[model samples]
Target: MKRITSFILLLTLIIAMVFPAPFAFAAVTQSAPTTEVPTTEVVTTEVPTTEVPTTAAPTTEAATTEVATTEVPTTEANTTEAATTEAPMMTTAAPGTTNPDTVTILHTNDMHGRLDAEDGRVIGMAKLKTIKDNVQPTLMFDSGDAFQGLPLSNFSKGADMAKAMNAVGYDAMTVGNHEFDFGYAMAMQYKQLLNFPIISSNVYKDGKSVFAPSTIIEKNGKKFGVIGVTTPETATKTHPNNILGVTFLDPVASVTAEMKKLQGQVDAFIILSHLGIDSTTKLEWRGDNLMNNLASNKDFLNNAIIVLDGHSHSVIENGQLKNTALLAQTGTALANIGKVTFDLQGKNATNITASMIKEADTKDVTQDEAVKAIVETAKANFGKATSEVVFHNPVPLQGERSDVRTRETNLGNAIADAMEAYSETGFDTAGDFAVTNGGGIRASIDGNKDVTVGDIIKVLPFGNTITQIQVKGTDVVAMFEHALSAPTIEKDGQVGLDANGAFLHISKSIKVHYDLTKPAGERVYAIEVLNKQTNKFEPLQLDKTYKVVTNDFLAVGGDGYTMLGGPREEGPSLDTVVRNYFKAADMTAYQSTELQRILAGTASENVPGEVTTETPTTEAPTVEATTETPTTEAPTDEATTETPTTEAPTDEATMVEDTIETVTTEQPTSIQDTPAASVEVKHDNVIPFDQAVKQKDKSQHDAKAQTDKETAHQLPITGEAAGTGAAAIGLFGLGLYLIKRKSA
Candidate 1:
């Protein structure tokens, strides 16, 4: 009976071992009952792998019983095995870092027209090549003013500049104001030579496409979208005639529209602007004049991360605006190279920084052989085209700095004299006075050697053409007065007149004087027109018109000379005049000639300067008699006694007309608006220049407000783990359970 009972127990244990009770259980054990069994009741332990069925009794009760108990031990062993196996799965990485791709961006700006090193200073194409070779997968860009600076750039009308840029492998470039110097025809010629795109969003020609506004370039599996914008003032401030058929659009609006169109398609957005840096206002329009509008317009700067600025010739030394955008510029004339690097991940630019590398710093770096060869070839070609003697100055020619402008500097005198001589060769109606802008002189004439054509070119880098206009004696005084008054004056007490106004350097004998202390319009209190036959200064009659010699830039009213553009006789090209001047002077010892010689004969003769102790009570003079007839001959005779015309109207309609009127204005024609004109001369009844400057300042202030608002929503979710540890643990447990069941 005991054996039977044992056998039954053994069968039950066997069935339980075979079935495994569906879930993990402890072992069942049997022990002698009564003598303090050590609480060892029959403990049945079920193994998860297989259930033990009691009905499947072992042939021997003892054997079955032992097997059931052994199975209980095996169940405990399985649980230990599961725990050991699951531990390693807890030690693996979360995800996503096994393989990664890296993208690098290399950038540069403001390469001007420099094609080679100048006097040990690296200026041109070679410098850019060195940078590109050193940095792999580099992308090169120019902010603007890539052409129109040196003689080579000028003589070829920027064709050489374009060819050189193409040879150097520029990826893209923006149009600068200076591009208009040669007119749109030359611009198109340059465009044809370029291997890359000429990008400018604001300039439109012929009511159709002219140049590409933006271009997307891909390198190393990364897409970079570049947009370009020239200053809006280009249409009016630059060559109006060249841009006559084209329209200059607002930069902010253009960029905004472009960015919106390119939104998710590009990995990064970059703006190459000819609009100089605005350091004073940071995000405001301080330097390039576009900052005020750009800062206020949110849509324009939306996704743009960096701006490569030019035109102001400033340098940004490691600074950022609004903590997101960075601004950088290389000082003008290719003195420095600007470099910026972008670190990108997938489609986002994760980091950015910039530096200005001066030629001094890059001097030691090895020159790129390929770029050096291209420069040498260009130099040889430029040298072969012209052969002429150039004058030189031992001392650096000083620029006009004082408020009383002096047009006849050693440099200005030289250039003016050259132009006067050059023009007479072709046109019998040669000009009397030679005029040039103070800004055109780029370098000082130094050293004792004879100046070569290259030396002259270095000083007069902008290839401005000489032009002659016929103006009345009365109009000349009016133009001179306009240049001397108000905003034209420098902070210093000195008069800010250029040589044409301050000294009146003439090819033929002429005399003029001004009362220093007198208010602007009254400063030219005494003026004289000389009869070369008599060689004596005489009072200028209001009605008599005079033939004036100047550059084409001024004949077309360049540099706010609206009076010069009005009905006047046109003479020979200004370039011809300047070249003739140099030839006539036959200046063998270039350094010996001083600029003072030009003004030696025109010193003010009025003793102690005549001062009206009290304001003149005399009524305003009557309208001066002047005609718009174009003449080919110079009048040697002088006339007297003409009254001035009535004051011009100051209404907006008139002002707008004045803004766009033709370059010629005879007798200050009542300051009436002329819609047909292209330039508005503020000399008449327009708002003061100071007030205009103030209005520009206000626009910049509003732009900063928009930048702050757009970046407001991107607060970082920093420290929070992307996934949780509990979720990982649960996944591991499930995996382990599946493995165990499959193995069993």
Candidate 2:
């Protein structure tokens, strides 16, 4: 009998060695981010190898990839490392979806006062409230800078936004630089109108935090300690005057203090932060900086489970932190709503996951009636201003920060033209040349579309007034030098723009030729001012004082134009000047100019230069991160802004995909597709969608590698886990063999 049993056991061992159990192969998959996705379309994959199971596992019914859609960071200095930390963001189940123990946190950051839907791009506040309602046991919050962009929100000085937010049911919020755009007092009024707390732990006045540093929110039998902190750049990000009474204190000190106080009282700590992930931000002010700074404290990392980030308008759908905590951010404007879920194992919050719910995902969600009424009311009041047609544009007006800051775009041309023409109407005297800072042009206007007063304001949101300054030709040269001083890179064929808020855009009446290849201060080889008297170009005289028209920001030496100091004469705001410019019958339509104002050489004359192949490549507009957070020099908004830009609301759908493609090209295919993936798995079971359906396909790998270079983008699973997971299959098989032998 013993001999027979040994023979059977040996046979079993041989079988195990030849065909490993699928469970054994599944060990490595255990570390898959425990995030819970909503009901998502599933693509079934089958393992072709005979030894492995050919049957495809059903994709989780109620879960999606909990898809991250974490757009690649386009800001020159930032990387996915800042957002992803060491792992993909995780959650155990969908927020408010069938998980009784889970508490959902619905949040938005850098909404920038987008109250109405922009075609299908922005779902508007009503739809946002629907998302909030779909997820039960939920609490909502806005990180900061919510009500400052659109006319509907700003018309009542954010009171409209407050009413809308109240209709949607927000639990708490933090202050952002733009929150102070109206004034500190207005921000306080906004708080008063809010049904919930507006916490800003680090902002101070009279030696005390002006707002509560943190608040306790109770839901689903769980107590959450929510701590809020604003960016230190707030000191000057708003009109330096708006924040005069309030001081932005040390965030690190303020946050750590809150952590100590809230340790044992709450189930978890949620850091409501406006400090963006801008790489250009100072070490002390960057959100990533504050995250690392918190690690020094003993147990702070343990309790802080998630951070809902803003200020850079980054599209970090879901990301992990070094301390194993999670972080999430929705791109700016009401483009996406963020959902966070904490799965409770009794009273302890265990599995935490984050996901971004785009409008497409919420097609079935009904708009909240209350929020819709509030939004409609605000729009009805501002309808004439926002909806009235100013003029139709023949072509796209490129005012993308990455574009305007780096080159002389058509939008820049129109702005400068407006400032120069202001002399005929608003200006008391005629001006010779007009200059507008690249940073002041906040948005892009779609071509062949009806432009409106709201559209103009969207492009020039800063409310900078038109002003005149007498700049000597030598000072003009110096100011241009300052504009070109920001460091830049050359890519494709054109010199890629180094994003700078101070970059100058000269009017059509002036021409400055310089070589980007030349060193900083010595780049200009020639300078010419359009001789208004002769209607011709003439060499700029170093000592001659030229009547220069510019925005008040530059006139006040904002964006570091120290040479701009001169006698000032203020006129209407820049937006009004542009509005009047567009209203002109001759301005019925405008087109993108080839090399407006600034040029690499004289060849790019007023006649319009031919676009290089590389220039068209740069035309792939920076999405999400495109809207600058309107900070001091850092310009945070999950971007380098992704400072916001939209040519048409319909174009937004395609651009959303472009934003993904733009981000994915920066990521490699090999890392995203792990070898263990040789065994077919669903995206819901593993990482993001992968090109490699069958890991053994070398031809596919080669083709995918080349494809990823152009447009296909992907995200990688935890590399260390992937490598170990593959090895676990073999080890698991061997363990079965050993166990069978011992039993025999």
Best-fitting candidate, scored by lDDT:
2
Alpha-carbon runs more than 4 Å astray in model 1: 1-110, 219-222, 236-241, 277-304, 342-352, 390-408, 420-432, 457-465, 481-534, 538-542, 566-576, 583-744
**Tens-digit lDDT track of model 2 for 510-584:** 767665666777566556665545444555677799889987656745555656764687765566667766666
lDDT of 1 by residue, 177-196 (tens): 76655555656656667778
What TM-score does candidate 2 reach?
A: 0.64
Q: Which stretches of candidate 2 lie over 4 Å from their true place?
A: 1-101, 343-350, 385-389, 400-402, 424-429, 446-450, 471-478, 485-495, 498-501, 513-527, 531-546, 559-567, 588-592, 600-744
Q: After superposition, how far is residue 538 of candidate 2 from its true place, in Å?
A: 5.3
What would the C-alpha RMSD of candidate 2 be, to one decimal place? Answer: 20.8
Tell me how far the alpha carbon of residue 201 in candidate 1 is from the true structure, in angstroms, after superposition. 0.6
Measured against the true structure, the TM-scores of the candidates, in listed sequence, are 0.58, 0.64
| Candidate 2 local distance difference test against the native | 0.58
